[model samples]
Target chain A: MPSSCDEKIPRIEHHQNNSDVSITICGYWSLNSRERLRLLRRWESLVLQWKDVLRFEIKCDESLVWDSSLVVFLRNANRDLSVNGGQVVFLDLPAGLNKLLNLADEGQKRNKEQKQDPPSDGFLSMEALLKPLDFLGALVISFLNLVRGRSVMRWRDFFASARNCSASALPIVTLISFLTGVTMAFVGSVQLEKFNATIYVADLVSLAMVREMGALMVAIIMAGRTGAAFAAELGNMNLNEEIDSLETFGICSVSFLVLPRTLALFVMTPLLTIYADIVGILGGLLVGTLVMGFSALHYLEQTQSALTDMWEVYSGVSKSLFFGLIIGFVGCYKGVFSGRDSASLGKSVTSAVVISVTLIIIADAFFETAFSLLELR
Target chain B: MNVSGRDDIVIRVESLDLAYGNHLVLKNISFEVRRGDCLVVMGGSGCGKSTLLKSMVGLLAPLRGKIIIDRDELWLNGDKKRKETLKKLGVLFQNGALWSSMTVFENVAMPLEIFTDLGVKEVENLVDYKLALVGLAGAGNFYPSELSGGMRKRAGLARAMAMDPEILFLDEPSAGLDPITSKRLDDLINELKESLGISFVVVTHELASIFDIADDSIFLDSESKEILAHGNPKDLLKENTLTKVRSFLERKTVNNS
Candidate 1:
């Protein structure tokens, strides 16, 4: 006494009408006609034991629903029959025909209404404003949560994150920092040699490296390279619902994912700044001794004396720390707040890098202003 | 056999309305799930099945109405209350959303590490036990990408079961799987439901999986965007108010064969 009421059409018979198309569904039913009607109303599609046929009753507003030339598509491995209703169509089936008819009525009503009121705005424009707001709110919450959750350091996780962010970043950071050093020395040599202050080039390079230039250069570089990457990786994961899945498993998405990367960048950024400082100074020294005709010893002597202040060193380190926080927070924020799709991830990552780098530069300007006003440098 | 009764009611979602702009995804949807009961939500794509699941979990807030879990009204907002509600449930996503970077052991152990005061050894043992429960004992060291589709699903199941939640939500757990594999996963779901004594609300359009495991189910009509019928799957197929449900069930049986 299975309750399925199935109607079967012979496989060999294809119903044809003068102008209207015939749709046949083959199946079997155990119920009586009245019960069959109830069951068919409940289930729009039928299940048959052997191959069966079903014929569709078609009507249309445009008279195209009854077109005999319409294509019949077999889907789901010949289990589904799809009829395309070109302009307008209403098909009488077991259950859904009534609903379709109602929809058609509704459409007709809307069409009439649209004609009456032509100035009506479509719904899509509202969505445009709301989506970015949604994204921004999620981003702010994600960033604040990460900050409040734990310490900005997780040693093991930092090591793992650093391997991802810093280790691969070494060659590029080194190259840029090296070039900065060479450029500084070359620029300084031209001016110093005129005053017979050729040896003072070391002093120029040292002062800039220790006080502001080294950290600024490295921070900007990391923001472009690693900050964007963090966003792309984490944002892609978020889009995939991976972060939500973690939450469902009773895992904190912020602690498990965000903390490690933030802590890693916090540690790595300073080390990278220090590395940049060394490379830049050496480049300056290379240009001074080789290109500017100053002795290596003379350049070394000036750098040693001019850059020995602890406060100068501290300033460079402190700026790196602040820069790291900015990049990490912005990158992780973008990642966790990414919408649930690939296109959203791409946009988030792009914004993460652009916003982070811009913020870092602004903060650097603030640093310059503070140091100058306070006479700390 | 342990069966669910009235007192076993776990989650009750009442008069839920969910919308994004003017597009109403779920309209006044209401349903109840009891402890030790398997409630399946069967619907086509864009029929608001997943949206309903998300609302119940408090991941997506309903535009109107309430969700009560174990007779307690779970807050859809407020940080403290949300965390408390979250602890009572576990979810397995459609794609097995395992963190690709972490090994299976880490993925399963994540919850234990986060919410518990357990020591390292105890956490490890707990993780291993959960993985073993899902029949993935020695595969703990493998990353998610290394596992096959079925194996990844199993790992996700293990992770979901790691916390021994009072309620479980699975989104399309058998999607994209072969019939045999899908059946195997459904069998695992059934075993977990019986053994854990936890309520399960699974969102799926896979009729075979639903019929095999569902104790009670709801069918969503795509065109009308409403609950066409709700009851035991077997009974619904027999005496549904909507022709769509009967047709869908019949189609399911034919295709599975």
Candidate 2:
């Protein structure tokens, strides 16, 4: 199909001597895409007519400038010929081309051997489904060891994780908390002003920040930031066999790696939530004074009066503790059990963030429902 | 200095000095690897043998020196020319750093796909041939985690050979293999060298592998931070020129026996 140019077109001459046949490939075999497609089509048709040929001999033109494309085409042709009880023989071929043909033949033979024994199918069985329960049991034992001061938890790693989870996360936490408080105040003031009840906007912002949004927003951010970091760090260690090395030294990897990370998160998340609550209140104070035209002192007084019962703030801070545990445990579990490869490590990090955020939301819902029921009682 | 007439001189490293930060690793090192020659770089555990190999393969730049491959100065060339020169060379890293994400077939096909305009079917056939060369023909579909350590090395070797490079660099090919597997790998290297006329730069501490495959060798001393000796392994053993080299080789021999 290629237009004949300066490059020579390959020609096949067939000669029959008794029951033997010889096919001579003449001219340049430097076939590109178009030429190769045409050549294969022609060869396929020619192979059907040469059924009587018992032995096939191939001879190439000496001045041929060919690539691997030629070799592959010939190999495919030979495969078709061999299936029909004909054997192809190379005559006067260059040493490199001959070696390539031999290598292809060897590969074909090995492929046949592999076909006899199929590879294992990577599927989770019933036993694999229950493996998480075993992981959980080991985690509980590690926690008990920590309680008794017998765990192999590294103080350095724990403090490093704590600093990363708390101080390093301050910027994003402050931004999200301030923005959430401002938006809530603005929306509530608009609705309240219609009823000449704009002064109650402070009460609305205080209740929302202390009871729900502050803790929930902080938890979601930590799940994305800290949870993904935990998964990636542990996944890298798992890929490098560092976990195995620790186990080889008689150290429990769960205690040494997971406990420190989880404890750091558990201790830090509530502190971060409380910080976010203060920042959120300040943001609401700004919106109340500047936008809603309320006095700063009046807004603060209204907020204090609405939060007379400390149960609202306590419930929100308590929810953060549970959210922190869920994020840390899920992240470490995904990381420690990650597959021993880079791709699986990436997948583990992704799943860790997703699962932690989802679990945090579910926990938040349960707490919100429980607190409302308690208020009614 | 007139290496132009000597077509056999494939690689020439002149007055090479390598450093990581201010700590010098190898100093004033010079070596030449000829065509069809297997140059084994030998040293103790912390010696700069692997670092020197990395410099030669363009993974690291020497602190001060020139590396000429086929008369083209590797470091002096621009990006395009450097890539052109690198296309003629293949490297197998320590621990067989195959992409764990891809299957073995895709790993071998990667170089061909990037460098050549060959179609998919042609690439598949070439990958098959390369895998077969390294005795991994049946492992095309298997991921790196699915294969044993030796198989991973072989798969890495197949990927390195996908381009049919003129110079092949292997770092610790026999590091994590059984005796029979190591021997088989050695045999494959020898066969490829003889059949394809490829010059090999192998970095290793295995005496058995060195004796079996090295046509020439250089010994780097950790204390001196320089090449202690250079010659054929057998001749170096017989000459006993450097006490450190002799002791290292003798210690390995004793361990083997």
Candidate 3:
């Protein structure tokens, strides 16, 4: 069947005179026609055999029916044959083919004529290493300007950021924190039950929530939700030249835009951490009451005792403030410096969330060690 | 450097050179925008006409030379002083660049609010007048997203005109607009020039608008990264010393016509 199909393809007949060749093509060459690649291969082999040919003329039949595929093949063939100072000239071709072939030639010429602006280096370029530090310097300047009461920020923008990272973020934080607490209690209860100390599940759940899980979970949540939003919003602003307008007006973009957003996250992260801590403890209390058959008051006593050292709670809350700043900072930095296209803007948003989450974990480790060394743990 | 008593010189660029990273753009561009003169910066695409405008308007720091706006060196001064110098300049960016978040009224009123001690009623009155001046009398309540491209450009011009700066640097004012719409914008620019005596430093390739608004003009060449010609567009057309400048003007007109 493939052999039968090949015989029905367009025919190529050539008449050669010394270094010059004229090839005549006849029949249909639509894009979907089968065995077109075979015909192209045949054409290629013929040109390869006539490597010394100085000029090849292409003559299309009066009844020829072809498409862009033929034009592309001819374009490449023309280029190949012309590589050794030879020329490919189309003879008696249809008007459309002539124009299309000319257009291909003209486009190449045009491309060569114009100086190309190199595409932006992708996400992991060397600039990425120093971007955080550059952003940090700008952030410090903005912070100082804010301290001096010279920052340009809208009160409502801060409220909007707070609302997004806090009020709207509450439901997800609740679900995650509660499930985490329940999971810890279930695991700890099973292990402690073997030794007849299932009551220690309450201590384990409350201690984890107070010392680490609470802040870390909230930071990761905001990183996905709030961090992504900040990146997208500011990236869009950069594309629209809103940032440039502000700068040309002599208004510092970091002071006007970044400060309000980062400050909102800084102020709200700890508050959300506390709320999550309380709800998570309630989740453990439920597990202790139902699964372990302990009174709710007894579970509360255990959690309270476990959290007796206020610094354990303070340790998590303090970390959250830094967590929030990191999220906002990374998002705004990625956005304000985003490239001038939708694809780059999207990449900026994704990287903002990723960087925020990664930085949050690393900073958490740093703070954890610092607290332990200072005897606050 | 010394304009002396020449009130004619509003903007003076002395051998300005600009770059992006290390790629050179404009080189040794020296020109003066006289008071009340509509100076058009005309060139082929990618010729750094807009880059030159950006440098003059305090957006890009030049690699060499100075941009003196009304006798104050723009880049040499403290940022506070640069900002003080900037206040004398209003810019209408390509694509209008209106704060999409703000209504047209608020967009125009913002500069007045931030840079002045005007009362609310005064700001409202001034915004209304500016809007009316651009023929967007009832469009003040609309956001930039709600307006057509031509109206957006008009709103942007209104904002640029809000501060009533000495020089208005417009980067491609007629871009992406229909011929009729662009003509209206050009006419509006002429109206403002006649009424308020504002100096215009417009960067555009629109031949019609160039002829319509430009009292003086400079042409930048991409190959040399320098100004190829400087004069009135009308005068330059008659005696084009270089074929490139002649073709730049003629080809655009031919294509449009």
User: Over the stretch A1-377, how does candidate 2's per-residue lDDT look in tens digits?
Assistant: 22333466655667788778888765556645476577668887888888878999987766656778778867877888888899888899877888998787776654432223323323575545666677777788999988898766667778989999999999999999999999999999889989999989889988899888899989999999999989998888677544543332235778878888888999999999999998999889999999878899999999999999888798899999999999998899889889888999999999999989999999988888877788821
- Residue B9 error, candidate 3, Å: 1.3
Residue A90 of model 2 has an lDDT of 82
> Per-residue lDDT for A110 in model 3?
57
Every model's TM-score on chain B? 0.92, 0.95, 0.95
Candidate order by DockQ, decreasing, is 3, 1, 2
lDDT (Cα, tens digit) per residue for candidate 1, span A162-189: 8977788888888888888899888888
* After superposition, candidate 1 runs with Cα above 4 Å error: A1-155, B1-6, B222-224, B252-257
Kindly report the docking quality category of candidate 3.
acceptable
Ranking by lDDT: 3, 2, 1
User: Top lDDT: which candidate number?
Assistant: 3
Instruction: Using DockQ, give the best candidate's number.
Output: 3
- Ranked by DockQ, the better of candidates 1 and 3 is 3
Q: Please say which candidate is ahead in TM-score: 2 or 3.
A: 3
